[model samples]
Target: MTRLGDGVRLAVGTLTAVPVPAPRQIDRAVAGVAMALGPFAALPLAAAAGLIVLGGAAIGLPAPAVAALALGAVALGSRGLHLDGLADTADGLGASYDRAKALDVMRRGDSGPTGIATLVLVLLVQFGALTGAISAGHGAAAAVVAVLCGRCVLSLCCAKGVPSARPEGLGATVAQSVPRAVAALVFVVAAGLATLAPGLPWWRGLLAVAVGYAAAALVLARCVQRIGGITGDVLGGCVEAAVAGALLATA
Candidate 1:
């Protein structure tokens, strides 16, 4: 039970900008447990964003403005980790088809034209979809569901059968750390929660979950094929893309 608490603390510390103290030690087992709790760690981020949306709506703010603010809140809460990953992945994929070269590009601390373009397009899509959802009276629910699905992809990416791109770093530490059964259970729970989100029918939420899963799967397959395995960047890209896909489905 103490170990479980530590794992949850680690997940909250690493995955969000929350000021939780880090555990004294983090090993493979702890990281695996943390990865399994990824979706739960995202609750604060989702809640912050949801509050922004609800508050903005109560004040007669435009849907676009509300959505942009909500996105800002989420970005701040998560410290833009996923967005950074998305950019790196794009730069890697755009630089070359060769696995080695792509990995090298992703490792560099710079954004290229492709990365910039990808970020712009993805943010635009998310903003537009969020605005539409808010206008349709589903702002808070959409925000929560989208953020939760984004974090849920981390578990899927780390599930057994997925390989790490490198032998070190976060990607390797958590790679294949989650069992397939656990991943499936997390997915089902995420879908169930989505179904209960405000202002949406259960079927719509389920459809959104399906879209999120499809988006994550596509990203995962492409990363495996191009980079030889999953990297931290790939995981990050999956989260952002999954969120966009979920919001779009809800819209």
Candidate 2:
């Protein structure tokens, strides 16, 4: 039988996007396809963005609903990766003064009031931006662009100078394994095109890029200073935050 141990190792390596192939190659051919997982991560958000557009068109759904649904899409696509970070960061930041305590709080699986509050705030901001965009009569295209931009921010974050916080967490794995240039190039071209889709002023796109990057940098700086480096959750929060900033700029 194809050994389960070998299978697990292969799967982990692939999901982690590690270039180093394992010696005990599992019969799990699916392992090879794992290489695409990093890029494929963008699809869910894109789908969610589409759904928000549909929601907007069908009844001119209020901004809150569109934002909620759109944020839902981002959550679905990311599988709550960043939300996890947001939760952990909240718990960690809320409980302790030093770095170690903060890290420990975050590492714990249990949620606390801080985590809950953080998630609520993040979702609210996301929804507000979606509402503003829709109200501006941008249609689903704005949602799509925001989703694309968010992913692009994620890719850029992973690709750039920020190092990983944990040795084995998702963020570090991506930072270490993925080809920085290819991933970054794909995200930039895709996001730039998507953000410009609304046919807004050229200045709007530039503004979004500038504002998004600035916000991301500040957040990243905090993550690094607070807990040593960027975590997977930090990456997700950054993406959502960037999208919010982008929508606000466009709005």
Candidate 3:
């Protein structure tokens, strides 16, 4: 039980700007455990973002503005870590098809034309889909579902079959940390919650889950084929892509 609490603390501390203290020990096993618990840590952040969207809507804000606000809240809460990952992954993959070159580009910490383009396109799609959902009176529900799906994909990325692209760093520490069964269980719970999200039709909720899973899977497969395995950036990219896909489905 103490270990579980520590894992949760580690997850929340690392993944978000939430005010949780660091765990007493930081090791591979602890990091792996934290990755498995990531979905739970994301719940409060998602709820906060959902409330922001709903509140903005209640004040008669435009759908696009409200969606942007919600996105801003999420980025602030997570310190834009995921967004950074997304941009790096895009730049690396787009700069070259060569695996080593791609990895090198990703390590440079600077956005290239392809990275900038990818970020712009993805953010636009996310904003557009969120605006559509809000216009349809599903802003809060869509926010929650999208955020949950995004975090859930992290578990999938860490599943036992997934390998790390590098020998060191976060990607390797969390690589294969989550058992396939655990990933499946997280997905089942996420899907069930999606079905219960307020203002979403059951069919649409299911579709959101399906789209999120497919997007994550596609990204994972491509990363594995291109880079030989997953990286921290790849995981981040998967989360954003899954969120966009889920929100689009809801819309």
Candidate 4:
């Protein structure tokens, strides 16, 4: 496969449950492209979410139930990857003051009290915000935007200058791989296109984008402060937080 093809496969394979051939080689360039295209790579999940919203709306399903279904699809589609990341990051954050101990806690597969609590809180907020948006008649738009938000922030997280918390693993491979300009361009395009959402005010769309990215930034800042840099888990936390922010803003 060509290098760009390798990047696409890497993005889809890692970001979603969809099976794709793993890249034969991984380097900074390939990793950068993968992160840059992360949002597009997740088109399947985003489209599934948007379709679920439309279908539920047509059937006059309860908004909350519809929202749950959409989110459940997203979680399953991605193999609950971000959810696992969010939980691990939370556990690490709440584990100890020592960086090594915190890292070790995150490395463990088990979820602790802090991780479980964090998951509950985040999932509740995500569901509530999406339900509200669906009720407001922007169900499809909200679903698509929220799902896109989850992946689009990957570029920003991997932008050049962001340090990896560890010397090895997925985080290290993609960390600092995206150029600042490329990340900014992708973000701008996503925000600019939000005006196309049905019945959504252009200003509101822009604000939603800003709010979503801002939420991701806040999570990233905290992770950096706590862990000295980001791990794969921290990136996952950012995605969930960004999704919630977008849904809340739309609602």
Candidate 5:
């Protein structure tokens, strides 16, 4: 029980900017819990996003602007970790067919053309889909669902058998850490939660969850093909893609 408690704290600390105390001990068991609990740990972020959408709509802000602001808030909440990861992953994938060169490109701080282009395309898609959801009065629910789905996909990415591309960093700590059963359970829970979100039918919720899972899987498969395994950047990219897919389905 203590280990599980510590694991929860670790998940919150890692997944958010929340200043929780460090875990007393860290191991594969703890890492698995942390990744598996990512979606629940993201509850605060999800609530903030939903509230932002609700408040923005109430104040008559344009849906597009409202969604942009909410997404900005989401990015800030996570310290822009996943967004940067997405860009880096894209740059890495597009950099070179050679694995070492691709990984080297991703390690650099600067955004290259591929990174810039990917970010633009993803941000535009997220913005457009979110804008539609807001205009349809499902903004808050959609926002919450999208955020949860994003984090939920992280568990799947880290589930057992998903190898880490590199031997170190965040990827090394978390890669293949989660039990496949746990990952599946987390995703199922996310889908169930989505079903209860207002203004979204159970069918749509299921569809959104399915699409999110599919998107994450595709990203993972590509990462494995390109770099031999998953990495922190790839996991981050998966989160963004999952969120975009979930929002699109919701809209």
Candidate 6:
């Protein structure tokens, strides 16, 4: 639990220019904590809840506007973990040949052409899905459910057995600390609760999980093969891709 607090500090540090503490220090300190409840995944779920509560007022707004606001809240809250991951993963995968080079590319902290293309494509897909869902009268429930369940996928990915490319990297800590069973429980419970809301069918929410899992398996498998295993950035990418995929599927 305390580690989660440390993870929170790390997350806060990443988002803001504020220097609270060393990220690697906080990362190590929060290893157990992050394992317990999920890290960046938790924040997006929280943001989704806020979006759901605000949906009544948001309903009148354009789908893109509402989605932008909600995504803005998530980006602000988590400090762009997913976006950065999305970028890094794109750059690395596009530029690298094998595990070592991919991991090296990801560590460069600079976006490449692939990263730019990925960012643009995902944004278009996300906004388009949001617009379609809202137009179809499912945005409020679908987006909320997708966000939470996407985090469920994040937790699940952390729990899976995958070798880290580098012994000292973020993936190593997460892979070692997170228990698959605990992560599974988080996914099941969160998805169940999110489904219990008034406007949505429970089956639809469960379907979102199915969609997420399928996507995660495919993406993470490639990630593991290409980079030797997952990292904080990959985890962030997983959440974003899963959530967006779920929203589009459920829509």
lDDT of 5 by residue, 1-251 (tens): 97798889989988889889999988878989988989878999999999999999888999999999999999999989888999999999998999999999888857899998998899898999999999988989888998989999988999999998999878888888999999989988888878888888888888888898898899899999989888888988999999999999988
lDDT of candidate 2 over 14-47, digit per residue (tens): 3232344473753323222222233344554666
In order of appearance, the predictions have TM-scores of 0.98, 0.73, 0.96, 0.97, 0.97, 0.82
lDDT of 3 by residue, 107-177 (tens): 88798888888888988999999999999999899988998899888889989988999897778888888
Instruction: Please give the lDDT score for candidate 4.
Output: 0.89
**Candidate 6 residue lDDT tens string, 90-128:** 888898687778888899979989998998788777777
List clashing residue pairs in candidate 1.
Answer: none
In model 3, pairs of residues that clash are none
- How well is each residue in 1-251 modelled by candidate 1, as lDDT tens digits? 76688789889998899898887678767777888898899999999888999999999999999999999888988888889999999999989988899999999858899999999999999999999999999988888999999999888999999999988878998889888898999899999988988888998898888898889889899999889788888898999999999999988
Candidate 2 residue runs with Cα over 4 Å from true position: 1-40, 176-191
Worst 10 residues of 4 by lDDT: 195-204
Candidate 6 residue 230 Cα shift, in angstroms, is 1.1
**lDDT (0 to 1) per candidate:** 0.89, 0.61, 0.87, 0.89, 0.90, 0.68
- Going through the candidates in the order shown, the clash numbers are 0, 2, 0, 0, 0, 1
Quote model 5's TM-score.
0.97
Which should have the higher lDDT, number 1 or number 3? 1
What global local distance difference test value does model 2 have?
A: 0.61
TM-score of 6: 0.82
Number of clashing residue pairs, candidate 1: 0
Better of 1 and 6 by TM-score: 1
Off by over 4 Å in 6: 1-32, 39-45, 48-59
TM-score of predicted model 1?
A: 0.98
Instruction: After the best TM-score superposition of candidate 5, give how far the Cα of residue 182 lies from its true spot, in angstroms.
Output: 0.6
Report the C-alpha displacement of residue 68, candidate 6, in angstroms: 2.1
